[model samples]
Target: MNYSPELVQFLGSLVAILAVAGLAWWMKLGGAPELSNEKEAQAAASEAMDGFESVETAVDANGRGAILRDRSGCLLLLKQHGNKFAGRLLTHSATGRIDKDKLVVDSGERRFGVVALAIDHAQSWADRINEVRSASDA
Candidate 1:
């Protein structure tokens, strides 16, 4: 079959574009990194939750998001979406509980998302959040 030059060029460009797109998806080019250290986790938290004056404690949720408590008894949930971070401030009414290895933060009416960190200290985060929540109540 004889192929026109225009068709050939168009096919080549399409293939190139597909290849680039595949590479980006494979490498997660604009995704959040799996935080392995406190500093990196803090940076991700800061980027995800702006205006966080100071971070008292932080935990990574398998690179998906972070559970952070600020100095002022604020529980912040930072979820990474593509290259951007979506943040939610868990109010004092929000209750925290651990189901298996995941810490579920929920309120009576609405529920916040869950963070699945590979760390072994899921309970620690839940406890801290509960402590802060209770403190604010008192």
Candidate 2:
């Protein structure tokens, strides 16, 4: 069999491209295991709230963030940032809304920015957090 140098180089480039594409597909960046149950949610919550001693309660569905309640009954929004997770405590004045599949929570003037949760049950999370906020007010 006879092969031209140009053809060999082209084949090599194609193979490299395919390999890279395959690796990216397999990696599933920003993808996490489904948090269908309390146990899985707790695990994600724990990872998000790294310094927290324990996660008393948590709500999550296969995605970016989780609503966590610590041992002190403090509500926190746990979100992924790069290789690690960060958390923002939900204060009494905290407010939230569901825009599409995202739960946007603003911890009033004290907190610097908004915490957006991209999850399956974004509305449910907003509702739950609002319910907690109302209950706390009462």
Candidate 3:
């Protein structure tokens, strides 16, 4: 069997191209679901605190605070101060727990999977007030 140099070079180049393309696809170089997920989170945040206005946005050495507020009182403060998630329901100090693959925030009085996001960083008891205001407003 006689083999040509040009044919061997073409095969080698084809293999290299395929390997590079596979790696690019695996790494998601062209922006995939990861980017969409971030946009989705932002949308969720907005939906969670619908009536609130962004009063202040701060990100210092300590952490980040995207403070939002409503007409009557403060709403949920999305804080990134050394926490697991980007933002959590910031009404109480108690940690979030899981119940049958669901998240529950135990604030002593109530324990629920979904709590309406209320005012952010307006007052000390802003979260409590927000819940009340939201109920009344609705």
Candidate 4:
């Protein structure tokens, strides 16, 4: 059977699109990652950054994110970035506020923006974040 040039071009484009989509699905390149437990959060944090050892971890109630604390009392925020997770070491400049069970944190990097996590003891985490700021000022 003979086909027109336009028909051939359309088929070629369709194949390319399907191939790309298949590759993305196979690689899990666009799924929302969640932390199912403290161990998983710690692992993701360590993978996102070098030399991060989480001594304490608080996974979000819904598993949307987590807050990890290293032995040195440094806080790390782990959140979904595309299909993977991104960890940001909460600097002294980082700040957080609590709303009952919710803790909203600002990384202080304008681009990184803010994140609100629902975890146990949100008030304590917010207080701990404040201590980070105070310690820096001291």
Candidate 5:
């Protein structure tokens, strides 16, 4: 069977597109997984900073982010990035505040930007994180 140049080119493009789509699906890079519970958040925080034992954690209501405190009073902020969660240990250069019922945390990394988590008693968490900032400043 004979085919025109245009038809062959179109078929090749379609095949290439399909291959890329299939590869993405196989690699599981399509969506970000939610941080559903404190265990998951704690794990992510530990991965971000080794020896980070979560004494307390507040999971975001929308499952987009989390904030955790270690035994030494250190706070670890977890934010969703791609399919996994990226974390920053809140010490120096970190700030937190409550906007309405949500706790907004800034890691001060600029690129990492800000993360807002809706948790119970957001202000308390915010104050705890600010304490981390204060202690580092002194």
Candidate 6:
């Protein structure tokens, strides 16, 4: 068969376009797994925190203690060094105590010794957490 030069160039261009489109499609499909994984993680987190009217967790920068507070105003103060989240309910404490009075939450793992700093920073960070939860719920 004899092919015209113009026809040959057109077909070559068409093939190149299709190849690029196929690659794009492949990449899009490949990203689906990551999306699904993130969805699953979000779902799990939601479920875990479900049934609580409003919940907030604050951890010290050193990861020593965490306070889990529910909508009812009840708070659970957890302390850990090697024990990890084990602590008695602190019934009495001095007012404005900076060392262990407040709860602080940090994103990454680090040794946080003072719960006061965590509590001081909690309001801003918790606002962000609430925003994320709201968006994820939607």
Q: List the residue pairs that clash in candidate 4.
A: none
Off by over 4 Å in 1: 1-32, 107-112, 131-138
Off by over 4 Å in 2: 1-44, 47-63, 69-74, 109-112
* Residue pairs clashing, model 2: none
The estimated TM-scores of all candidates read 0.56, 0.48, 0.26, 0.77, 0.76, 0.31
Candidates' RMSD to native:
6.7, 9.1, 13.3, 5.5, 5.7, 18.1
Q: Write the per-residue lDDT of candidate 1 for residues 1-138, one digit (tens) a residue.
A: 999999999999999999999999998788654555666656766776676754654555466666777777677776566566666677666666778767766533343445444444777777866776787789
- Tens-place lDDT per residue, model 6, 8-126, is 99999999999998998877743311112323323323344454332655545544444555566433344443422333222222111223444343322234333343444555544
Cα deviation of 65, candidate 1, in Å:
1.8
Superposed model 6: Cα runs more than 4 Å off:
1-54, 92-96, 99-117, 122-138
Q: After superposition, how far is residue 121 of candidate 3 from its true place, in Å?
A: 12
TM-score of 1: 0.56
What would the per-residue lDDT of candidate 5 be over residues 16-129, giving only the tens digit for each residue? 999998999898876978888889888888898888998899999888889988887878888998878899887678888878778999998999999999999899988888
lDDT of 5 at 100: 78
lDDT of 4 by residue, 1-138 (tens): 999999999999999999999998998777777789998988898897888998989998878789999988889998777768887988888999976669999988888878889998898998998899998999
* Backbone clashes counted, model 5: 0
lDDT per model vs. reference: 0.66, 0.67, 0.41, 0.87, 0.87, 0.43
Worst 10 residues of 1 by lDDT: 107-116
At residue 54, what lDDT does model 1 achieve?
41
Q: What is the model-wide C-alpha lDDT for candidate 6?
A: 0.43
Query: lDDT per residue, candidate 2, 1-138, as tens digits?
Result: 999999999999999999997897789755444445656556666565566554554444445556766677667776555545566677767888987667788867554467666655667667767877898889
Location of the lowest summed lDDT over 10 successive residues in candidate 2: 53-62
Candidate 3 stretches greater than 4 Å from native: 1-26, 29-45, 59-65, 79-86, 94-138
- Note the clash tally of each candidate: 0, 0, 7, 0, 0, 6
